[model samples]
Target: MTAIELTGVTKRFGDVVALRDLDLAVEDGEVFGFLGPNGAGKSTTINLLLDFARPTEGRAEVLGMDAQRRSQEVRRRTGVLPEGFRTYDRLTGRQHVEFAIDSKEANNDPMDVLERVGIAEAADRKVGGYSKGMTQRLALGMAITGEPELLILDEPSTGLDPNGAREMRELVREERDRGATIFFSSHILEQVEAVCDRIGILRGGELVAEDSVSGLREAAGTAQTLEVTVSRADEELVASVRTVEGVSNVTASGDRLSVACDPDAKTRVLERIESEGVTVEDFSTEEASLEELFVSYTTDEQAASEQRGRTSDGKNSEGEDDERTESESESEEVRA
Candidate 1:
């Protein structure tokens, strides 16, 4: 079943359009990555799902209900970590999570949630004293108060240290394993590349690409990085492998060779190496990274967004102001 679905969703703020004829779907029980540069309608799409704002045209559905019409019910089953949420400063971490549990009408032990987010020791500390990473963890703990079916996380790794970011990625996987659908958004391409089963990239308020990482590499005709551990690596082997069609670059070290080539050229690469009297002990092909694929698709649009940002009105071409205040209003809805 699809946990989230949007069809022909166009959101406009007066003369500026934040989204245009967008269509997206995230399957149940999968970690789906939502990617876009600043002002790419990423937040607009999130707002539409939670019914914080209505689409100017078309429809949005979450958990099988009309997002705009059944908003409260939808919010009840969904957990959100918005980009700029303001947590209560005077409250302790535990207090924050307990309040979320109460608001969600859930019977959860606050400490368990805190522990899951790696902030249990600081559970009693006032949020005002917490570091940015710790505060982010606290918000995440609160969002998981009810074991929500859908998790909408916007830049979840913000302020998290390397270790904290890694832990958050693991938590996302755990939640997905427990039957939750995660709509993860982050500028950290590695994090998205690691956790996402599939990705949808938004550009100029439209989804420019949506597919698995491998699918995207194929669609873009990007090269794969092939690492071959050979019994011997020599210039002869390197030069011979380079002669193979589609083999772009070859680098050799002690007993290993790194070859960048087209996916179909992999077999010929190996054959060339073996024919050159080198034993291919082991080999692996790594798909192009999500970052490379992302840049390939959105570089032009990003440049365009920058040019539009210079407009006298100060709104991003993608309508970053696209009613940014709506995000603040939606924060209240999420907290409620």
Candidate 2:
């Protein structure tokens, strides 16, 4: 079953487009991660799924129902830890959980939910006295009250310390094991990389990549750096290695040559080196990390924007300098 689907969805805030021609689907009984940098339309997509805002074009469906027309039904079957959720200052933690249960018409034990979230000891404390992490725990407890079929968490680890974050991830796994579809959203790649069954990366209001962690690593064209210590290294050997398909950035320093290429291309590079008559002594390969892969996919637009800004600034500075020179020339001519 499809837990959530967005087809050709576009959301415009006046002149600014938040999401554009976006298409995505999260299946039932899996943990899906929505990953992106800030202002990448992750929140806007969530809002559309919950009917907090309507899309300017296309459709959003949650649990096989139209998100806009059947929002109440969607909310009833879905548990959400919404971004920037707030608590009633005077209400106790237990009260918050009870409110959620009542709203869902669910027969959940408020104390049990508090215990599950590791906040049973503070169940009676007023929310105004709770620390940020404590409040986040209470909100999570509220979200899981009814054991909803689908869970949508937006930055669920926001205020958590390292240990608290680990605990939260464990709970996500538990929820998924209990036959609930989990949609986890975060800007932190490490957080979701561990728990997610599949991940979708959003950039410039579009879904740029979606796949398992290993699949994404491959699709991102992340390569391994192979460093070979040879009996001899020279310009000719380096040039030959560079000519091999998929091998790139080959550099020679003394008896060591460093070549950047995909894992599969490592053998081909070695063959080329041997063909060039350089005896290999030893070699080591360093694979690209997940963080590196994340940056590679998401930073292109940002880098381009920065480059454009620098070019514009340079042009404006040149123009100003030319104007000053022309003005000085005009003043000199008048004096003459």
Candidate 3:
């Protein structure tokens, strides 16, 4: 069953469009990541899902309930850790969790949730003295204290260290394993790559791409990083290597050549280097990661959006033309 659904959701503020016909769905017990550049309306969409703001058009649903009409009920069953949310400065970490329990009318043990979030040791310290990472942990603990069926985390790992980030990812997985759906929003590609089962990338208030990490990488045609250390440094040989098809952005530092190339083309590169009589000392290829793929898509999407805006003469282009054509055909009468 789908836990969250947005159908053609649109929002505007005066002359600026925040979201334009955004459509998305997240299945139950799945970790869905919402990725986007700044000003792409990622937060706006989250606010709509949480019913903090009503959409100008379209509809949003959470847990099979209309988001705007049933906001109170939705809040009762969902946990939210919004970006830049501030906790009570005088309240200790434990107090924050306890407050959440009270606010949610849940009978959860505050200490247990604190310990689970690795903030038990800091439970007694006032939130004003807590570091950024500690505060994030406290927020997560509060969000999870009620064990809600769905969790919405916005930039949840922003202040975490490497270890803390890893723990956060594990916590998200654990929550999903326990039958909770997670909608995680972040600009950090690595975090999304590590935890998300599926991803939706927003650009200029539009969902430009939606797929699994691997699927996005495949769609972007990202290349692997191939590093090779050779015994002899030959300028001609390096030039030849650069000419090899599917190789991109080749850099040679002394005898080591770092080549970004399609992973499938590595064998051909190896054979060409071997035929050139260069003694290869060491070689390895790391697969194209989700980070690279995200960069490619976000960058391309931004560029494309800009191009469209620059070229548009305030009229519908091919996309709008196709839509108009389809609508006309759909509305036409059919003869027997």
Q: What TM-score goes with each of the models?
A: 0.71, 0.75, 0.73
Write out the backbone clash pairs for model 1: 319-322
User: Which of candidates 1 and 2 is the stronger one according to lDDT?
Assistant: 2
Question: Lowest-lDDT window of 10 residues in candidate 1?
Answer: 308-317
Candidate 1 residues lying further than 4 Å off, grouped into runs, are: 220-288, 301-336
lDDT of 1 by residue, 42-88 (tens): 99899899878899999999999999999999989999998887889
lDDT of 2 by residue, 1-336 (tens): 999999999999999999999999999998999999999999999999999999999999999999999999999999999899788989999999999999999999999999988999998999999999999998898888799999999999989999999999999999999999999999999999989999999988999889998797776456777899998897667655654556545668999998877788898888767866678899998876676667656775333333332322222223244534444455456557
lDDT of each: 0.82, 0.85, 0.81
Across residues 74-159, which tens digit of lDDT does each residue of candidate 3 receive?
98999998887887899888889988999999999999999988989988889999999999999999888788999999999979
Worst 10 residues of 3 by lDDT: 308-317
Candidate 2 Cα deviation (angstroms), residue 309: 12
Models sorted by TM-score, best on top: 2, 3, 1
In angstroms, the error of model 1 at 216 is 1.7
The TM-score obtained by model 3 is 0.73
